[model samples]
Target chain A: MNIHAIKAIYRFEMARTGRTLFQSIVSPVISTSLYFVVFGAAIGSRIAEVDGVSYGAFIVPGLIMLSLLTQSVSNASFGIYFPRFTGTIYEVLSAPVSYLEIVIAYVGAAATKAIIVGLIILATAALFVPLEIQHPGWMLLFLLLTAVTFSLLGFIIGIWADNFEKLQFVPMLIITPLAFLGGSFYSISMLPPFWQKVTLFNPVVYLISGFRWSFYGQADVGVGVSLAMTLLFLGLCLAVIWWIFRTGYRLKS
Target chain B: MAPILSISDLSKTYDTGFQALKTVSLEIEKGEIFALLGPNGAGKTTLISIVCGIVNASSGTVTVDGNDIVRDYRAARSLIGLVPQELTTDAFESVWATVSFSRGLFGKPKAPEIVEKVLRDLSLWDKKDSKLVTLSGGMKRRVLIAKALAHEPRVLFLDEPTAGVDVELRRDMWRVIRELRDTGVTIILTTHYIEEAEEMADRVGVINKGEIVLVEEKAELMRKLGRKQLALHLAVPLAAVPDGLSAHNLELSDDGEELIYTYDTTGERTGITTLLQDLNATGIRFRDLQTRQSSLEEIFVNLVRTPS
Candidate 1:
């Protein structure tokens, strides 16, 4: 199982986060808090509630999902990509660790970091809005599933990217915009019927809707559909990761 | 005892169609220093990369202590350590942390004592806490060695271990390598410095253009191909060598003041006594004479310079 190798890689990555606490944890936490102040408090006070939930509270799950998606992708991508860029990947490649263990170590650490940041954002959100969890168990499941799934996507991106610009390309140009338009600051139902249909194409919507359903128990799509959709996306990411390891993709030549 | 490492018919052709290695084969004893000497682009690095599992080989197989490198990679790799050519490291990591991390990566249990010993042996103990980015190039090279040794592998492959380092660090590195050898760890190194091979190698292998030209014990290689030259300074200038010395194939100096005779050192008869007698009979008076033996560098150059 090479458990020691996994632990070594995981601890090394976690230590890197500790060393760069400001960029890794504090920066994202502060940014999400600002989003709460500007959008939830300042702006929500002027708008009516959606789905019987207050506007500020309505965006909690969406905001948390937003942070989870971006942070997971960035963290996981950079975790693997930095070694490749610095030429230190030779150590990892030559080690007795298998491909599965490498994926587990890198993706697990990234998910852990994303989950920590999500929790911190949730705590900060409490100060801005009255929050409640109708199904705490479901909420935790959604959090873990979302964190792990996006982290896997990030792992694929890390292997696929050849340059720093390409590394940032997917997370910044693709993920952030999808999360914003998917449902972060508002419900997809608020959009016109046609645009609401189009918004379904954005995979982030399924994650946000599934996560929000666990909180207030009212979601735009049926909760069952949201769960299925999340799992489907998770399955897709897993398949891609398996293919990467099988083919050695950009990780080996 | 069985060889610690064996390579048979290994070949590598990169994606770009560059054939880096071609049917290479070699073996290493359990506790000897084997030096692979070659010039740039001679497949030294490619061969080491394949054995270390960093680069996949195009054909053939390698085994470490009877564990097939591909089929049983974990067991095979666990027995080997590689100090790569480049000084690549995590810039933000401390020396102690990185070395410990390497040990753990090899699936070894945490042994701080072993890590400390490796660091101290490489003269990196005092700087263990310093970030890698802050260390000098020589210190970073030492840290690389410390990382390779952290796991206590049975065999160590050093790819250009002394390249670009200062003389003092090079000497320290040699001392550390010798100490490792004394501990019964098999050592294989590839080097551009023939003197490094001459100074440390028990057996030397010369590679050129993706082929192994020769592999022999250092002493035997030097003797087999080595040529000795005898130069005689004549008391008077002469236009050419004496007719009596033509059988000896002697060369006259451009200024005609000295004569040079070349002979194989490994030959049963150097004919020095007979040459001296013939010189005296021919009245070829000489003021002084000196003999020189060719160095390993000359032999290596001759080995690689010719077509395979």
Candidate 2:
């Protein structure tokens, strides 16, 4: 209910993103752009297209999702973790702000940053690949939902991580590999029977597939199921965060 | 008038089973400087942390202006401004922005004039545009105080506001604190400096072993506990005290050069006249005599050493 509090926290975080411009926005866009060049040259020559889209265009949605997931998680996680590291979190915890408002401000700012990065990558991708949007509304929805979900996950990681080394553990050891194997580069349908079945178990596959379906109208799974899975993950993150505040875990102590 | 803040049976037992507080209770008047004095690991910080809601209380009830700190936390917290012991602030943000942002965190509407006034009062108006990382340690401490005052709370808790600063900065901080107190803000500070309490606090609370050992008006406590010592220099060294002076509380110096007598400042008759007459009658002559009163530091040490 404290609107000013939320704005203060939100604006402060957003200002930090602006301050670390290269690390926050430019690096992810540039790295995703490099993916476009290397994959377009190396893989585009061998395969003409995956489904009806060109090989170059096929990875655009997937690459954007890759950066979105990573940046959202890292941004929200570091946003909270740095405060804890410096012992400045006591300021926010003692303020008039509630736990839900704290979560909303941090996660919302992080998602906003991730969404902007996703849009910029989309624009950058257009310079190389001939892309088409089948459903712009659904694409926006997918982008917003994925950023919020991953940012919430990052918020949890921030609280659970006690040290700087542990802060980078999940993004490096778990998320990157999942993004690579989640059909971000090549469609899971192109793999053999057993490998395709194995790829389906990776949760990232559902996110990317649902997102890509809104682009080319073709996907590895039904759009409805992918949306449901994302909501389920979002709910799970919410439950964990609610428990964190209720029990005063890591934050209150 | 009701106390601005009231705490009853407050306690905190950490997960590790360490009992940090044991049924501690306190009340703060609306416009007075109160000091909590204790040594390290004496739970001064823990007690403040619980009242500020940074640490959960194991069992207690706290009301700030009739607002329960736990049940109506938002309302209660809005009235409090805490300058914590640790130096923690956003190094990236400018002084003006951070202080302004802190005000908003208390749900107060934007008032640039108030922010400007707080900055000027803290002697930080010149550094308003400077980032915190660029500021000196003393300046950062000032900024922390400015941030705490940004909300204009009725009660302010300064937890060791002058811990590591130099003498000049400590004096400056004390002046700022006194100025705040003059504006009718109830100031509660925790410190290990007996001098600080003697110089500023109207009431002093000595906390030790997770309990308040003593709380009394500074003057009253000093009068009641303060003792005066009289030392007499003997013209001729004596191996033992004179038999006539046996009734007087006296101690012989090991070097056999002086006699010491201790007396209470609050006692109407210190018996000094009779003791000196008895010494003269016993053929004891003194070249010089000096009287000294015990300081708050000695009183604090004695209080902490004894079981409450």
Candidate 3:
């Protein structure tokens, strides 16, 4: 409801991201570029094609998703964790802003940053391998949804964590591994049948599959299912956040 | 005029079963400076935290200008600006940006001129472009005050605003606090420095062990604190105070079982030795005596006891 307050918090967070461009934007961009080089160039050269697309191009969407997920989590988690770490959250807590507006500002800024990083990485990938968007609209949709969704997850992680170590814990321990196992480097179909079924249980598989579908008209699962799973995760994070503000969990008291 | 902030039967019990606040009740009038005085672990912060909505109360309620702190939190909170005891700031942001952003957080429209005015008011305008992390501790404290004032609320709560600052900064902070009060903002501050309360407050509340032991006009609190009570156990149960001892400031107990002496603890002499000699001469003997400094009776004694 307080649009001005949201904008204030939003611009401030975005400014912080700008001040630490190296840590916030550049580091992730560079790391994803490394993934493109090692996995796309060296590894893809050994394999001629998968699903009728060059291996280098095949991993493009997946690699972008990897950085998107991690960057969203890190940007959002640190955005909030730093305030809690420094004890500046009392300002926002005592202000006229509502819990919903606070979430909108923080999560919105983080998602925007992650999406920007995703777009820049997409640009960098174009330098290495030829790329195409079979469905440009869907590509943007997948990118926006994933950024917003993961940023929400990151917001939850931030509120849940009290220490810097814990802030980094979820992104490092849980999300990174999930993305690696979720077909960010290879299609899940390439796995053995039993392994493929086990990999299906990983929620991130839907995101990458739907995203890759938007890229090259290929996917390990239906696009609808991917969209559904993403929305489901988004809803779950929203519910948890609502409960957090209601109970004042980790934030109010 | 109605009270600006009213708290009734507020209490807080930590998960560890430590009762930090027990049924605290207080009313802060509009435009008056009120001071809350208590020692460590005395629930001073707890009470402030609850009223600011940082710490949820386990019982009772708080209302700011008739808006319930819990039921109508936005209305209640929008009226309050808090300078927390801890020195916390946006470390990477410029002083002006942080203060302006705090104003926006209170849903106020952006006014760069007002932001500049707040910065200048705190003498932070020169450092407006400086990153917060680069500023000294005193400067950072000033930024925190600026941020709290950026909202320009009807009431201001300063929790230990000068706890660790130097004397000069403390004086500057007092000036700022008084200026805020002069503008018709109700001010409530907590401090270990009795002199600050003595110098600034119109009303003073003393909290101890999670309870408000006394709340009165500053003058009354100071007046009550001017003396100590020494109870003398008597060897003989006299029918009345010895006529000879009437001039020595002594009162015989109802049954003459003890002699109660009231004396200014701050006087050049307590006159105890002379009183004892007079008692000996008056044929009045005492078996035992004890000096007590209860909350209401010895507030000044404790004030003078503080190392300043």
Candidate 4:
């Protein structure tokens, strides 16, 4: 299993987060806090409630999901991509570690970082609004599943991207917008009937809806469907990763 | 004893349609310093990359200490270490951390003493805590070597270890390499610097156009392919080489003050005595004479210049 190798890589990646504390931990915490202040305080003042929950508290889970999704993708992708960019990937390729171990180390570390950020954002949200968790176990499970799935997707993007601009392409242009439109700031039901259907198509919606359901027990979609959708996406990411390693796509030549 | 590393009929045709290696086969003995000498783009890096598990071969097999590189990669790769040509390192990583990380990457248990010894051997102990980007180029090169050695592999491949370093660092690196060889580590280095091979290689392999053209003991290869030249300084100037000395195939200096005689080193007879006798009899008097042997550089140039 090369457990030592996996530990080494995981520790190395986690250490990088420590080194870039401001960017990795502090920046996300501050930005999500702003989302709370502006959206939860300024905007929630106008709307009394959504789904029988205070508007300010209603957005907490969604806001946390937004950060978790983006952070997971960026962390995992950049972790792998920087090594490729700097040519340090040669050492990793030549080492005794297996491809599965490499993926576990990188994806595991990315997910860990994203979960930490998610928890910190949740704590920050508590400072702005009264938070509740009807199903704490479900909430944790959703956080874990969503972080791991997005981190795996991020790992694929890291391998697929050949340049810096492409590295930013997914997180900035695709994920952030998806999270915004996937019910981060408001419920998907608040959207018109047509746009609500369209919002369901965004994968981020399933993740956020599942997470929000765990928090308030009031979800736009059935909890079981959201859980199934998250698992389905996780399986898809795993399949793509398996194919990538098997074919040596964008990794070996 | 069986060879520490063995490669057979290895070939690689990249997706770009460039054949980097063509049916290459070679064996490196344990604890010997073997040098793979070749020009740029001669597949030196590709061969190393394949054996180290960085690149996959299109065909053939490589075994490290009898472990097949493909089927038993973990064991095989654990037995080998590679210091790649490029100076690729994490700019933010401290020297100590990176070296330790490499050791762990090879599935070795944490051994601070071993890492310390490697760092000290490479003269990197003082900069152990410094970030990689803060180190000089030469120091970074040393760190790469340290990283490769951190796992204590049986075989080490150094790809152009001293390409752009200054003379002092080159010599220092050579000394470190020798020290490693003395510790019974099999070293296979790829270089175009003929002198590096001449100075350190126990055996030399010449690869050209994706094939190994020759592999011989350093001293034996020199004796077999090396040529000798004898230059005679004439006491008096002459207009041309005398017709009588034509049998010796002598070449006269442009100013006609010297004569040169070339002969194969491996031949039973150098013909030098006969040439001297012929010179005296022909009244070609000389003030002084000197003999020079062809270096590995000349032999290497000649080897690669010709179609194998």
Instruction: Go through the candidates in order and give each one's C-alpha lDDT.
Output: 0.91, 0.92, 0.88, 0.94
Kindly report which residue stretches of model 2 are placed more than 4 angstroms away from their true locations once superposed.
B233-239, B252-258
Q: Candidate 3 clashing pairs?
A: none
Residue A43 lDDT in candidate 2? 64
lDDT of 3 by residue, A155-242 (tens): 9999999888998899999999999999987888889999999998899999999999999998999999999999999999999999
| Order by TM-score, highest first | 4, 1, 2, 3
Query: Which tens-of-lDDT digit does each residue in B94-132 have in candidate 2?
Result: 999999999998899999999999999999999999999
Question: Tens digits of per-residue lDDT for model 4 on A18-105?
Answer: 9999999999999988887788888888987898999899989988999999999999999999999999999999999888999999
Docking class of 3: medium
Query: Candidate 4, residue B186: CA error in Å?
Result: 0.5
TM-score of chain B of 2: 0.95
Q: Which candidate has the top score in DockQ?
A: 4
Candidate 2 vs candidate 3, TM-score winner: 2
Better of 1 and 3 by lDDT: 1
Model 2: per-residue Cα lDDT at residue B196: 92
The per-prediction tally of clashing pairs is: 0, 0, 0, 0
Off by over 4 Å in 4: none
What is the per-residue lDDT of model 1 for residues A1-253, given as tens digits with 9 covering 90 to 100? Answer: 9999999999999999999999988998889888878878898889898889998899899889989999999999999999988888988988898988998999999999999999999998998899999998989988999999999999989989999999999999999999999887788989999999999999888888878989998787887887888899899998998898777777666
| lDDT tens digits by residue: candidate 1, B135-172 | 99999989998999899999999999999998888988
| Segments of candidate 1 deviating more than 4 angstroms | none
List TM-scores for all candidates, in order. 0.98, 0.97, 0.88, 0.99
TM-score (chain B only), all candidates = 0.97, 0.95, 0.78, 0.99
